[model samples]
Target: MRILAISHLFPDLKEKRYGIFVARQLSEIHRLGAEISVIVPRVWCPGLLRHTERWKNYDHKCPLCRFEGIEAFSMPYLRLPGNFYNRWSGLAAFRAMKSKALELHKSRKFDVIYATDFFPDGDAAARLAKYLKLPAACLSIGVDVNITAHSSGIIYRHFIKTAKALDGTLACGQSVADRIKAVTGKSPLCVYGVLDLEEFSPAPDKIPARKELSLPPDKTIALYAGYLTKRKGVYELVEAIYRVQKKCQDLLLVMCGAGPEETALRRLIREKGMEHTVHMAGEIEPERMNKWMQASDLFVLASNTEGMPNVVMEAMACGLPVVATAVGGLPGAIGDCDGAILVQPENVDNLEKAIVKVINDNQLRADMRIAARKRAEEQFGVKRNAILILNYLRKIVEEKKAKQKG
Candidate 1:
C-alpha cells in the first residue's frame, strides 16, 4: 500500500530530534511493505522572529530530501503560536502543501492520506483528502487531545470537525482515545508507539556505559529526559531529587534535554545545594538515548500531561524500571509491567518515595529489569506495532475502494 504521511512535527534539518517517534514509526512501517512518503510542513515566523537563530537555521533548508531511505518534502506555511491561531495555521498549512500533495498523489498513486497528529496535520489531511477524493486517517500522539482539545478555544470545535471528517483515527493510548470520543463521538483505534528493541537493550557492562557517557560509576543514577519546563514537572523533579538526596547521598539525578526553565531549575538546584547531586546533561542526540538509559539504575518523569510517552517504552526496552506520574496515557503505557511504578503528578513527596524505593531495593530492581524487557518484547516492539497500524490502514483503503465500486 502507498501512503502520504503528513506531519508538521517531523524532524527536519534544523531539528533532528523533533518528532523522532514519527520518523522511527514510518521507517518500520516502510519495512513492513508499505510505500510511504512524508510531507513535513515548515511553519512561518513573522518580523524579528523570522530573523532569529531559531528561524535562521531553517531558512535555507532544501525543499525535498531523503530521510532514512524514505522520500520526504518540506513546504512553507504561515503559522502563529497558541490556540488562537490553531484554525488559521492549519488552513495555511493545508494551502501550502495542497499543490505538492496533489502532484505527488498523481505521480505515486497514494492509497490514503495518513496524518501523524491532530491539529494541523490531521486537519489539513482532512481538507486534502476531500480535494483529492481519498481516505484520510489521523493519529493522536499527545498534544492534540491533552493541550489543544482541553483548551477553551475555537480549536476545541475545530478538533471535532477534523476528527469527524477523517475516515479513520488512532490514538497512542486509551486516555487519548477517550478524549477523541468525547470530542468527536467517534471511537479511535488505540495503537501504541513502537519500541526499537535492538537499539535499546540492557548494558552488558553498566560501568563501561557510564565511563563512555562521563557519568559517575560509583553512584546510583536516575535519569529524566525530555523538556526542562514546568509542564514537564522539571521543577517538581528537582525538588524530589533533592529530598531523595538527603536520605541517600550516593544517589544522583541525571537530566537530559533543554527548555525554557533551565535558569529556574539551576537556581532551585543552587538554593537546595544539589549542584553536585543533580547533573544537567542538556540535549543529546536521539541515537545516544540508549546509553543514558542503560547506564541509569532507573527512569523517572514527572510530567503533568503526556500521550503514551515513547521515552517510557524506550526505558522499558532498555530494561530500566520507571517511576513516572500517573497522568495522560502513562497508566496505559506502563500497564501491568512490574518494572515500573506510578505516582501522582506534581507530588514531590510521592515522587521522592517511589524513586527511593526503586533505588534502595536491589531485588525489586532486578525483577523490574527483567519484566521491563519482557513487556517490551511482548507488546511494544516496532515490528508488531507497524503490522497493527498497517493492517488497519489496509482495511480502511479496501473499504473505501469497495464503497467506490458499489
Candidate 2:
C-alpha cells in the first residue's frame, strides 16, 4: 500500500523529538512492506521572527527531506496562535500543499491519505483526499479530539465534521476513540503508540547510566519527560514536588522537554525554593532519552489529559515505575502494567502522595521495575502494533478500490 501521510506533527529540522512516535510508526510500517511519504505543514511566522536562529531551525527545507529513509516534505501554512482559527489553518494547510499533493499523486498514485492528528492534520488530509479522489484515515491522538470537545463552537463542529468525513480513524487509546464517538458519532481503531524496545530497554546497570549522564547515583530521581505546557500539568508537578521535598530531602524531580510553559514552570520552581530538588534539563534528543530513563528510579506524569503518552510507555520499557494522572486513555493503557500508578487528574495532593510512595518503598520499587519492563515487552512491542495499523490501512485501501470497481 502507498500512503501520503500529512501532518504538522512529524519531526522537523528544529524539534527532532516533536513527533518521533509518528516517524517510528511509519518506519515500522515501511518494514511491513508499505510505502509511505510525509508532508509536514510548518506554521508560518512573520519575517522578523522567521529569520531568527531558533525560527530557522523550525523552518523545513521545502520540496524534500528524509525521515528514517521515508520521503518527506515540509509545507508552510498561515496559523493563528492559541488554535483559535483552526478551521482556517486546515484550509491554509490544504491550499499550501494542494499542488504538491497532486504532483505526488500523478507520479506515485497513492492508495490513501493518512493523517497523524485530527484537527488540522486530518482536516487537511481529508480535504486532500477528497480533492485527489482517494480514501483518508486520521489518527486521533488524545488532545486533537478531547480538548476541542470541551466547548461547542465552530472549532468543535469542524473537528466533528473532519472525523466524520474520514474514510478511517485510529486512536492511541480507547478513551480517545470514545471521545471521537461522542463528538463525531464515529468509532476509531484503538491501539497504543509504538516503542523501540531495543533502544528503550532497561540498562544492565543503573549506576553506569547515571555516571554517563552525571546524575547523582545516590539520590532517588523521579523523571518527567514531555512537553512543558499547562495541559501537561507541570505547575501541579512542581507543587507536588515541593511537598515531596519537605518529606524526603534526598529525592529529586527532573523535568525534560520544552514548550510554552517553560518560563512559568521555572518561576514556580524558584518560588517554591526547589532549586536543588527540582531540575529542568530542557530538551534532550530522542536518541539520548534511554539513558535519561535508565538513570532515574521512576517516572511521573501530572498531565491533565493524554491519549497514551509515549513517555510513560518508554519509561516503562526502561523498567522505571510510572505515576501519572488517571485521565484520558491512561487507565486503559496502564492496564495491569505493574509498576504504573494512577492518581486523580489535577489533584496535587494525590499526585504528591503517589510520588512519595513510589520513591520511599525500595522493595516495591524493585518489583515495579521488573514488572514495568516485562509489561512493555509482552504488550507494547513496536513491530507488532505497527503491522496492525499497516494491515488496517491496506484493508481500507482495498475496500476503497473494490467500491470504485463495483
Candidate 3:
C-alpha cells in the first residue's frame, strides 16, 4: 500500500530527538512493506524587520529539510510577524501538500494518508485526503491534544473538527482517546508508543554507566527524563524529592531535559535545600537516555497529565522500575506489573512514599526491575507496535476499497 505521512513535530538533522517517536513509527511502517512518503511543511521568512535574533536560533534543517527517504517542502511567510499566525496557519501546510500530492498522484497511487497531531499538519492531511478521495488517519501523542487545547483556542477547535473529519484517529493512551471522543464525539484507537527493546535493554555495568553520566556514586538515583515543564509536575517532583531527602539523605534525584521551566525548577530546588539531593542534567541526547535509565534504580514521572509516556517505556525496557502518577493511560501502560508503581496524580506525599519504598527495599527493587523489562518487551516493543499499526492501516485501506467498489 502507498501512504502519505504528514507530521509537523517530526525530528530533523538539528534535533533528532524532537518528535522522534513519530519518525520511528513511520520508519517501522515503511519496513512493514508500505510505500510511504513523508511531507513536512516549513515556513520561509521573507520580511527583514520581522527577522530578529530569535529567528536566527530556529533550526534551518527543521521541517523543511529532507531526511533520508522523506519528501519535505516549505512556504514563504513574513518572518517574526508571521510567528503568531503561522502556528494556526493550516493554509501553509495545505498548499505544500496540495502541490506535492498533485506531483505524487500523477505517477503513484496512494491507498491512505497518515498524519500526526498538533499544529496544522493533521488538518492539512485531512484536507489532502478529502481532495484525493483517500482514507486518512490522525495519530495523537500526548501534548498534541493536551498542550494545544490549553494554549490555542482556534487550533484547539480545529483539532476537534479535524479529528471528526479523519477516516480514523489513533491516540497514545485511553485517556487521550477519551478526550478526543469527549471533544469531537469520535472515538480514536488507542495505540501506545513503543520502545526498542534491544537498544534499551539493561546495561550489565550499572556502576560504570552511572560514573560515565557523572551521577552520584553513593546515593540511590531516581531519574526523571523528559521535558522540564510545570505541567509535567516538575515542581511537585522537587517537593517529593525534598520530602524523600529528609528521611533518606542518601537518595538523589536526577532530572534530565530542558524547557522554559528549568530556572524555576532550579530555584525551587535551591529554596528547598535539595542542592545535595537533586541533580539537574539538562537535555541529554536520545542515544544516551537509555544509559541513564539503566544506571538509575527507578524512573519517576510526576506529570499532571500524559498520554502513554515514551520515556517510561524506555526506562522499563532498561530494567528500571517506574513510579509515575496514575493519569492518562499510565495505569494501562504499567498494567499489573510489580515493576511499576502508580500513585495518585499530583500527590506529592504518595509520590514520595512510592519513591521511598523503591529506595529502601532492595529485594522489591530487584523484582520490579526484572518485571519492568519483561513487561516492556512483551507489550511496548517497537516491533509489536509496528505490526499492530500496519494491520490497522491495511484494514482501513481494504474497507475503503470495498466501499468504493460497492
Candidate 4:
C-alpha cells in the first residue's frame, strides 16, 4: 500500500533527539511492507523570540535528519508577524502544506494520507485528502489536544472541525483517545508507544558505563529524562529524591533534558542543599542516552501529564525498572507487571516510597529487571509495532479500493 506520512514534529540535524519516535514508527511501518513517503513541515526562523524571514534551504547531508526507507519531503514555513495569534500561524502552515501535498499528489497516488498532531498538519492533511478524494487519518501525540482546549475562537473551532473531518484518528494513549472522543464525539484508535529493542538493551557492563559517565559507583542512581517543565513534576521528583536521601544516604538522582525549568530546578537543588545528591546532565544525544539509562538502577518520571512517554519504553528496554505517576497512558504502558511501580499522580510521598522500595529490595529490583526486558520484547518492541501499523495502512487502502468499486 502507498501511504503518505505527515508530521511537523520530526527531528532535524540541529535537534536530532526531537520527535525521534515519529521517525522510528515510520521506519517500522516501512519494514512491514508498506510503501511510505514522509512529509515534514519545517518552520524556519532566526531566533526563538524573533521571526525575521523564511528560508527554504534544505539540509540533505545530515544522516540523522533523514528517515530510513521512506521518500521524504519538507515544507518550509515562516511564522507570520505574530505567533501569539496561533490561528494565523496555523493557517499559514496549512497553506504551505496544502500547496506541497497537492503538487506531490499530481505525480504520486496514495491509498491513505496519515498526518501527526491535531493542529496545522492534521488540519492540512484533512483538507488535502478532501480535495484529492483520499482517506485521511490523524495520529495525535498530546500537545495538540492541550493546545486546542487552551486556545480560543478560530483555533479551537479549526481543531474541532479538523478532528471531525478525518476518516480515522489514532492517539498515543487512552487518556488522549478519551479526550479526542470527548471533543469530536468519535472514538480514536489507541496505539501504544513502542521502542527499538535492539538499540536499547541491557548494558553489557553497567559498571563501565557508569565510570565513563563519571557517575558514582556506590550510590543507587535514579534517573529522570525528558523536558524539565513545570508540568513534568520535576520539582516534585526533586522533593521525593530529597526525602529518599534522608533515609538512604547512598542515593543519587540524575536529570537529563533541557527546558525553561532548568534554571529554576537548579536553584531549588542549590537552595535545598541537594548539590551532591542530584546531578543535572543537561541534554544528551539520543544514541548516548542508552548509556545513561543502563547506568541507572531505576527510571522515574514524575510527569503530571503525558501521552505515552518514549523514555519509559527506552528505560524498560534497558532492563531497568520504572517508577512513574499513573497518568495519561502511563498506567496502560506500565501495566501491573513487575517491571514497573505506579503511584498516584503528583504525590511526592508515594513517589518517595516507591523509589525507596526499589532501592532497598534487591530481589524486587532483579525481578523488575527481568520483567522489564520481557515486557519490552513482547509489547513495546519496535518490530512488532511497525508491522501492526503497516498492516493497518494496507487494510485501509484495500477498504478504499472496495468502496470505489461499490
Candidate 5:
C-alpha cells in the first residue's frame, strides 16, 4: 500500500530529537512493507533563536535519501508563533506542501493521507485530501490535544474541524483520547507499542554498550530523556541526584534533552559543583537511543504531566529499570512493573530515596532488567503496535476503495 504522511513535527537528519517517536512509527510502518512518503515543514525562526538547536530547521538535503527506505520532503513556511498561527497554520501548511504532494501522488498514487498531529497537520490533511479527492486519517499522541489545543481557541477550532473531517484517528493513550473525544465529539483508536523491539532491546554486554556511548562503565548511569525545565522537575531531579550521590558516589545523571531551563540548570550544576556528576547530552536521535538506554542502569523522568512517554517504553524495551513521577499515563504504563518505581512529582526526597534504593541493589537491578524487557516485549513492542497501525491504515484504504466502487 502507498501512504503519504504530512507533519510539521518530525526528525530530519540533523534534528534527530525533533520527533523521535514520529520517526520510529513511520520506520516501523515502512518495515511492514508499506511504501511511504513523508512531507514535513520547516517554519521560519528568528535570527536570535536560530543558534539554538531546538529552533534550527533540519536542513533539507536529498529528500529521497533522507531515511533508509521512506521518501521524505521538507517544505518551508512562515508561521508567527502563538494566537496568530491558529487561523492560518493549516492553510499555510497546505500551500507549502501542495505542489510536492501532488507531484508525488501522480508518480505513486497514495492509498490514504495520514497526519501526525490534529490541528495544523490534520487541518492540512483534511484540506489536501479534499482537494486531492482522497480519504484521510490522523494520530495524536496527547500533547497537541491536552496541552496546545486545550490552551488556545484557534488551535482547538482547527483540530475540532479536522477531527470531524478525518475518516479515522488514533491516540497513544486513553486519557488523551477521551479528551479528544470530549472536545471534537469523535473518539480515536487508543494505540500503544510504538517502538521497535529489535532496535531497543537489551545490549549483549553492558561494558561494550557503555564504551560505545563514552559512558563510564564504573558508574551507575541514570538517564533522563526529556525537556530541561522546572515543569519537568529537572531542578528536583538535580537536587535528588546531589543528595543521592553523597551515599552513592558512582551515580551519574545523564540528561538527554534540551529546553528553556538549560541555562539555569548549568548555573545550578556549577553552584552545586556537580558539573562532573550531571552530564548534559543535548537531544540525540532515536537511533542512538538504544545505546544510551542499554548503557544506563535505570531511566528517570520527573515530568509534571505526560502521556505514556516514548522514553519509558524504550528504556523498558532496552532491559533497564525506571524511576519516574506518577503522573499522566505513567501509573498505568509502568507503576506496577517490577523494575519500575513511581514517585510523586516534585518530591526531591522521594526521588532521591528511590534512586538510591534502585542503585544500591545489584540483584534487584538485574532481576528488574529481565522483568522490564519481558514486560516491554509483552506490552509495548512495535511488532504488536505497528501491525495494529498498519491494519488501521489498510482499513482506511479498503474503505476508500469501497466508497469509490459504490
Candidate 6:
C-alpha cells in the first residue's frame, strides 16, 4: 500500500478522456495490491494562451506521463490565468511539486497522499501530506466541491482551510458527501464512480448499435453525454430539445462532451431551429464510449449539479434508459434505481416530460431496458468501487500507524 496521487484529475498522454475516472480509480487501486503514483498539476500554458480553446489542450509532453501503467507525473506550475487564481492553485501546486515531492519521497517510500481535486488536487495533497509525514486523502469529484469550492469566497476560505489537512475523505455521490459536510465539516466516503461493466455492455440491439455508430437511421436517439457547459444542464438540454421537437418529430439529441459552452451552445442550437433537433457529438473516445452507449435509445442528464455521473453509470452500463437531474450523487445514485429517471434541476417542463416519457413508451422502453442493465450489475462494480478505495486507503494507512504508536 504505497500511494502518492496528487491530481489535476489524472488522465494524460494528451487528455486521453481526461480523468478517465481518475484512471479507473488508480487502475482499480493497482489491482488491489496497491502501490500507485501520479502527480498531474499542470497550469502554466501561456504564450498567447497557447491558441485559446482552453489553451489548445494545454501543450503536452508534461514530464513523464503514463496512465494505465500508473507511474505518472506532469507538475508544471504558475497560476493567475483563467479560473482567476484558483484559491492559490493548491498552494501553487504545492510550490510546483515541492522538489518533486521530495524527490518522490526519497524513492517511493510513500504510504499515502492522494487527492482528486478539491482546490488544486486537494490542495496539493494537503501540502504534500504536510511535508511527507504521510497520510492525506480525498476524492470528492463533484465539481471540485459542488461547483468549484462552493462558488468561491476566496475559494470558500481555502475550502475550509485545506479541509483540515485531510486524513481521509472520499465521495462521488451522497451529493458529494453532503457537499463535504456542507463545506468542510468533513465526512466524505460516498463511493459512486467506476464502471467497466466490460466496457459498458448492451449492444446486439438498437439495430446493431445504430449500424456501428453511424447513428440516426430512423431516429429516436436521446444520448447527451457530458459538458457543453451551463453546469451541464446544457441550456436546459436545448430547452428540452425545443419542446421535444414540437412533439417527437422522430426525435434525437446526441450531445457528448467538450465544454466552455461550445460557442454558446452552438448559438443556442442555431437560434432554436435546433437544426434537425440537436446532435453535436464532438469529443468522443474513452474507447468510443461503448458505441455511444450501445447506440442510444434513452439516456439524458440535464444536470445542474452532480457528484454521481460517470455519464450516469455509463448510461446504466449501456442498457440505456435514464433521464437524470435530481442533482448531485443523483438522488442516491439513480434514486430507487429501476432503470433511472430522477429529473427536476432547472426543470424545463420537468426535462420535457422525462424526454417525452422515454421517447414515447414502448412498454416503458422495454421495462427501462431491463432495469438499466440490472442497475449496472448490482451497482457500479469496477471491483466494487476499487474495494471502496482499498478499504478507505487502508484505513488511512492504519490511522497513520496509530499516530506513530501514540
Question: What lDDT tens digits, residue by residue, belong to model 6 across residues 24-112?
Answer: 87888898888887878877776687787667667645543355648887778877655547788888889989798789889989888
The residue ranges of model 1 lying beyond 4 angstroms of the native Cα positions read 50-66, 183-185
- Off-target runs (Cα >4 Å) in candidate 6 are 4-20, 23-37, 41-43, 47-74, 77-102, 107-223, 228-261, 275-297, 300-309, 312-314, 317-358, 364-366, 382-406
Query: Which scores greater on TM-score, model 1 or model 2?
Result: 1
Scored by TM-score, the top model is: 1
lDDT of 2 by residue, 98-184 (tens): 999999999998998989887678989989988999999999788777775444588887887888888889988888888787766
Ranking by TM-score: 1, 2, 4, 5, 3, 6
Q: Which stretches of candidate 4 lie over 4 Å from their true place?
A: 44-64, 78-90, 150-157, 181-187
lDDT of each: 0.85, 0.85, 0.78, 0.81, 0.81, 0.80
TM-score for each of the candidates: 0.95, 0.94, 0.88, 0.89, 0.88, 0.36
**In model 3, which runs have C-alpha deviations exceeding 4 angstroms?**
43-88, 146-157, 181-187
Candidate 4, 319-371: lDDT as tens digits? 99999998877776676778999998889999999999999999999999999
Worst 10 residues of 2 by lDDT: 56-65
Give lDDT tens digits, candidate 1, residues 34-57: 899888887765556757644544
In candidate 3, what are the lDDT values of residues 1-406, reduced to their tens digit?
7888887666666666777787777777777777777776555543462357446435444443344445544333222333246355665678756876878876778888888874567778778888888998888776677666556666666777777787787888777788888977767777866577888999886898888877766778899988887889998999898888888888888999987688988888888788888899988877788888878888999999886788988999999989999877787768578999999988999999999998889999999989998888788887788788778778888888898899
Superposed Cα deviation of residue 279, candidate 6 (Å): 12
Better candidate by lDDT, 1 or 5: 1
Candidate 3 residue 343 Cα shift, in angstroms, is: 2.1
Pairs that clash in candidate 6 = none
